[model samples]
Target chain A: MKSTYLALILVLASAPLWARTTPEELAEHPRWKALLHINQGTTWRYQGRSYIDDPDFFLHESGATDARAELEASIEQLRSSESEARCDFPARYRFLSQQLDWPDDGALSHCSEYQEWRGAMPEERVALIFPASYLNSPSSMFGHTLLRIDHGEDEDGVWLSRAINFGATVQGQENSILYVYRGLFGGYPGYFSNVPYMNKIRDYAHLENRDMWEYQLNLDEQEREWLLAHLWELEDIEFDYLFLDENCSFRLLELINLARPESGLMNDFRLAEVPANTVSSLDRAGFIESVDYRPSKANELDALVKQLDATEQDLALALAADHAVTEREAFRELEPRRQNLVARTAYAHLRLQNREGERSQAAAERGMALLRTINGTPTVSGIEPERPVSPEKGHGTKMLAAGGGMLGDRGFGELQARFSYHDWLDNPDGYLNGAAIEAFNARIRRTEGDDLTLEQLDVVNIKSLAPRNSFRKPVSWFVNGGLDRRFIGEKRHLTRHIQGGPGLAWELGPVMPYAYAMARAENNSAHEVLVSTAAGARAGVLWYADGFQLGLEAEGLYYHNDDRRYRPSATLNVPLGRNHALRARIERDGGPDRAETEFHLSWRYYFD
Target chain B: MRKTLLAAALVATSFGAQASAPGGSGCGWGNMLFEGNDGMPMHVLATLVNGTSGNRTFGITSGTNGCDTSGALSYHGENMLAQAGVMEEVAQDMAVGDGEALTALSVSMGIPAEERDHFKKTMHENFSTIFPSEDVTAEEVMANIQKVMNQDKQLASLS
Candidate 1:
């Protein structure tokens, strides 16, 4: 009896220490380190109290605190609770349970709702949803990324898969300027929201005309379960929204990294994260298994129109127009095959137009009638274009170019660098055709015996020319605001310029020609030096086949200060490899005082 | 306006008794956007809304279609593509009657609140003729709607 009492006392003494770990030992735990590394407990001042954006994720204490205390407290709670507690992250518990070799009791079975969701979303197959960049929308200019939990549904159920999306929840209505400012800074709180994949299709494919690319990931069931579990943990959790770094793509990468810690997808992105870059990282990590493309309504219509002859195209246009009876008569005259094509094309055209009320109603009814008439025969066929190389297969986002050539008789060495994104003149292979968006692009040149001069510094420049085709006619536009050096007298003067306008473009066979009328203003130390403004017109024609490209552009600038100038330029680009290209350019500038010509040859390298 | 009312009258006449039958359809005007077949008016409306409203239309439209809910009915346990097929069939004629397959679909293709009863009445009246049996398929429903339209003088004249 005396020995038994002593042994009981010894067992009781060690039980408390086993249940509650020391802060230092808890700090060494891998799960603890993972949570801290992800900024799980990072606190920010909001209103007055310190707020930890991740709601109920850390249960040791409210607000931001030490991870050690949280882990120790969690273990204590776990030991005392009869059932699995609701306060801890299920993934974390699973990790800790394995790390510490805890018993296989039902203590961690609290998350029935989440378990049900997980069962519905089979972890065997997963896909990454990338809504390719739509330059027209400011928010989508950088593109967006989401994760799809594919449950292996049938063809129709494929769209029923659940999607994990992280986006900023705008707190209140604000003006455009304020909204932009808030979006850039941390004024909004970003959160993870789950929805069916079909909704995203409707938004991007049908409404916004942005194509979606699905890249199925090659993760094992274990890795996929980890991803789903972490995503479930992130549900309804808020994170400070920073447009540059902690945006949608960045958060998605972090989530992916949590699943495969050694993959280190987040490490490559330090300051900025682009959706395409993350995709490239996933590819590099050997996560991508296969790729599929879902063409937008506009894409299909564009492709279909190319197959039609001029007469068939005109018939399609008539069917899409408001004259219902005439269009019907014209539609019926075509052969069955032609009729089917025209009816489908007309329907797509009308939908793209998106009219309203009774007139649209009648045209829709009429379009349906045409389709119904053809349904008895055979349906129109949809011929899909060969999917372009995946965005991951494209050249990297960061570009560096170095070359030396004669500039107006002066031998100068020019170095150009672009921090992020694509330019039209660049190889248009893994990007949207006729679309360009660049940030922090600069060109510096040093004369043979002179100091380096900043020839151009563009903060942001975006241009989208969705060429007008028979089926759809969308406005083509360009907006460029930056600083440039203009040759004034004998030297160059730095001038700030803002220019933008809308125009039209058409694709004729292998060549696409475009024109834009723009209002441009340049302030060169306005109060001290030359101040000039111009309403200008620019025309360009581009011919591209395979990987070779040649472009010719002419611009006539009518200045308010009588510095009227006309500039014509031609460019030839040849691709050297997947990530390298050589570009040659020659330009002639004609102004009131004199006429000068310049030439440049540059070798460009891209890095992702 | 006269032409539109006539079309509506023709639809009403055909669908009057069986509008609320199982799998009965609605006006299906909203799908003009979904099917990429909007008329001039719908196209104009879509353009106006797409320009100014951002994704509000997505919220409105998807929510109307039961996309906002987790337990959305599948096309007889079929996948998304099959559900889309059914939607296309329903778009052919919104005025049809109730059936087991269309319960989920009708919720998705919600008519204007005020027009629900009239739309339902139209579907109830046309249900038996459209279905003819309990196991009627979407393709059958579409073919039947096409037949009804073919038989109507006003609709046939326009076609």
Candidate 2:
């Protein structure tokens, strides 16, 4: 009887050790859900299954959709020595081992490849890098975001740090139209790449002339390790690239959220992920540790030119144009400091010109000579470029406005909504000067006793007014296409039209005046043909001050069918705060058959 | 005057041809520098749709994308500046005896902060030798830099 009692006690004592963790329990873990990128939304659905689009990323057949199955398969695969699971999914292995009391049997130590890669890139710190908007490039018009991994500064500093970039793996030599189509519709596979930080600086600051902002992250060491482990597991993984939402910035936020689940970096960025808005979100979430700005080559040259007088600027320009100008009295009469400045400016100009054109022997020789002259003189202290307002300080990307306005003899209440971006009359605190980009802007009006009618719907509108200066003469241009209600004789009809052209703009202090000779193609109900084209001209003056904006514009169009139209408009915007504004606009539209006058005052609110 | 200019051009072309073909080490630095020069259409299109030209490296090798791991001018077993296109910037910075590119190069060479000014001064004085011509390759520039640094007491220890 005593032996039987002892046997029962022994059986009871070993019961807890034999109890195994169920797949359901492991699958329900928060870390497991994060590893699978399982977010609570219909937008993240892929193939009517899970968020991950890549089949290779899953270990089980239904791993993409079935978390419990994936966990079971992962556990089984991890136990086998011949399987690639340990190396292929190190982050999963690390998590599983920590959660379950796995024996220290050298399972992780066998992952030589993962060990080597992890050892090579010891991530002690991370920084979110934002290459600011370059309006000239369509892809960069919204800016770009990436991550830089710093292994605590050695003698080499962070210049050799590794930069993690996620972008579409675009196919070969596609045309612009096809490229845009593929980019918008997820026809391309996006992947994460690791590159040296210096290469990025060279590409952005030197070649593309885009300034970069680096925001150091405050992730703890444990969080950084978790992030790096997940990053390694994503090697060669592909994600469907959607230009608007599932883009580079969005994927970066996913990685960040995986590191600190409580951070919720991806929560409020479901609809649209503007790069600047993401930066603002990071700032709000307290992920930003510090901020640093690196100026572009153009900014550097501009700063240098600002130090010189008008005659000296002319001299520098001459030296850049003609190498023989260096021997002239005008050049030799300057002090050594001034001479150094002129030579530096000339060299920068030559470099910039060479970047845009084929290499010329004469220009190269001139550049070499200028460098020699610069080296012979005593080195001057470098001048720092003026820093503009940071992107996060700008008003949000989406806007909504409500107001009452008069159109001809009718008074109406109008509600306007813009899906994205900045416009000329919007606050220009953090946006590029003289630049405007809007997409999917819609206005609906309700007449005093009538039903609501769509007034206008703009699919895309973009404008860049780069002003001409003594040092740089950039061409200004605008393009817009949309549906608008136009006066056709005595009735208003919806017309589809696209207009664009190139022009020149000059900056007079805070006021910029621009003019464009435009051509338009439209499908109007009143047109004699299905599609009618028109030639027109547009002139505008924009004045930006403290927190206020004013724009005066006029346009004239002559259609192919002998229809003439003239329009003049003025808009004034006053900011109540960063996200609130009051705008007033007045316009007179005159056609060959009829004329109408309209005015409106609106209160606008902006959000991300 | 036109004849003299033509003669100088011919001489430069011949010199360029004779001087050890820029990227003889198979690092393709010259090609990298001239990468986006395929006219405005492609440049505008590529930059418009995708921010990058889609040349990606999955970290299979130690040096991920542009750098050639087998190159002579390597740091931590990976070439730091082989295909970065920063050679021109570095040359300009070297001429001025101070700039961001100069500092980056010094750091890549493992020069300590206290010795960076000396390194920059050394490179500044040797700018002509480092960049003898516009067609000078990154390998040649690196070789020249190492030669000059080897001659300097403070920088020699770091290099």
Candidate 3:
């Protein structure tokens, strides 16, 4: 009788262990934690809390903080036929059923809403769609990333594929300043949205004139299904949108990581996230199976225009400007093929012009006429834009440089660190050429027998040198605001300044030369005036190649206090490899009272 | 049997929602082509924020809400190319006689692989009829495409 009682007790104790997954164990599971978006206490303030900002996402009262209790409550709710947990959290139900070996009671099978939604999307493949940077758009300047859920085997079917995007929700009438301020400080709520891929293409390629790169992932069938299921759970869920770290690219990475937990794509990015850097991370993680490029409409137009001769180009431009040009002798004399090319170019130009602002009725009519003319002729060979190097092949966004150089008369050892993004002299392989966007760039120098001093701190500096041709005339512009060491009278003082202007750039052979008429405001400590404003003009020539870049620039500024300053600089950058480069600069600073010449040579290392 | 019935009911409800008003009144033919343009400040703001102003779609339903279900060209519940921006691309591609947009439209229309070239050719030939005017609605364009497809022996079955 005693032995029987002991055996019975042993069976009861072991039964609890073998029969089901403990709430504690299920709470700590990687997949469960991922579904809940629970951070592993890595982020300082958000440790052990869910990343989801919305309270509705959690089932239990303490669900956001206490995973074990949430799991227990969720299991109870899922098992109860009276509750809507199975329908509301289908992914959780599916996961729990597998883990707990629950009976096939058709509980989840009866989740009609989820079943119908799942039935609609029979996706078997996924690709990461990255729209390259558009300098005209401040938010897109860092580039943007989204996912495309592909169905069927047809290559053309990609246009119909569903795109999953995460972005901030903003009021329609928000001004640009408020938009930037809210985007930077996480004042807006970000949500996941699924739209047709073609809409995204229209927005990125046709409207914004940005090229897109598609990185088809190598996820298997089961993994793809899990991603889709998780995506459903995230429907209508909100997250705090922080531009630096928890932005669009970061959210997409989270989704990809949840799909294949082993990918661990989110482990490295801690401080800030840039869209291009995420592509490099995915490539490093071996998630990319293949890469494809889709050129923008502007690129297509450029290619079409290139195929025409100088005279034909002029005719094409004239035809686009005025549909009446088609009746002219110069247009009438062209061969059928040349006429088709010109007509096609004209149509593309009209479409691009109509993309922004109010569409002129005349432009629309011309577009239709051109299309009709093109349709009447035999179809020529299509134009394919030349693909540049992939974004992953470019140098990393964060840069560190170490060197020593002569500042005025003293020898100084300088350390420069740019928090994010490329400059004109940086390797331009994977980035936009003639465009420079740098944020939080800081330089420190220690002169002979002197303490280390902050040389310069640039909060934001953006330069877009869009070279103009006969076909399209884009204005080149630059804006820079920062603190820099400048000579006020005879002493070097750190001054805060903001300067910007609009200019024009033209490409001549291998070089692009630009000139800008600039306005500036400065707060200088050594200056007699508390705040000094200036009017200035700058001219620069940039010659860039695959492995080397050289720039010569000069500027003259006349301050409100009648002090005049001139600066001329020559910079050369030679990229040794993808991530290493040697840069040298010789600059002369001419002030009202004195002039100083300085030289700097540095080896730069690029990293994410 | 019960699960299937429930699934049917759910699908019916979703379809009902879609049929009633998918994209609300804001999704009209007039707003389709020039939808993104909303004056200089809004345009500049959109460029800077990259946010979809007042767009709150969870992607549960079909992504497109511009399809006119009342039209005869409604195939498979939603017309994939009904969005104005995509319609514009389709019109352009149809004019070219061959392009990605045209091929995508053919695929969406359920045209077989072998019949796609014939469909493209037919659409190319009928570009003027399909896009009668720049202000033509997506429903009209889709109807014209269907009519053109029906006339072609190879693509009639797809229509």
When only the first chain is scored, the TM-scores of the models are 0.89, 0.92, 0.94
TM-scores, all candidates, are: 0.78, 0.87, 0.89
For candidate 3, give the docking quality class from DockQ: acceptable
What DockQ, on C-alphas, does every prediction get? 0.06, 0.12, 0.24
- At residue B60, give the lDDT of candidate 2: 13
**Model 1 over residues A301-343: C-alpha lDDT tens digits?**
7777877889888877877774363346665677777766666
| Candidate whose DockQ is highest | 3
Error of 2 at A3 (Å): 54
Backbone clash pairs for candidate 3 read none
Tens-digit lDDT track for model 2 on A285-345?
Answer: 8999888889887888888888899999999999988878878999899998999998888
Model 2 quality (TM-score): 0.87
The list of candidate 1 runs beyond 4 A from truth reads A1-52, A62-65, A79-84, A108-110, A119-122, A153-156, A322-333, A355-360, A380-382, A526-531, B1-30, B33-159
Q: What's the interface RMS deviation of candidate 3?
A: 7.0
Winner by lDDT:
3
* Tens digit per residue, CA lDDT, model 3, A1-608: 53344345334433544346567766766667778888764343367788886776788888888888778888888876545767767778766776776777876676666777677664878999988877444446678888998876687778767778887655444565666687777677777766667667766777667899999999888778778888777766778777877778877888887776656665542687788988988999899999999998888988898898999888888888888888899988988778899999887776766665445667777777888889887668857888988888899999999998997889999999999899988888998878899999999999998988999999999898888877778888889999988777787788899999999998775699999999999998777777899999999999986569999999999998888889999999999899999999999986889889999999999987
Q: Place model 2 in a CAPRI quality band.
A: incorrect
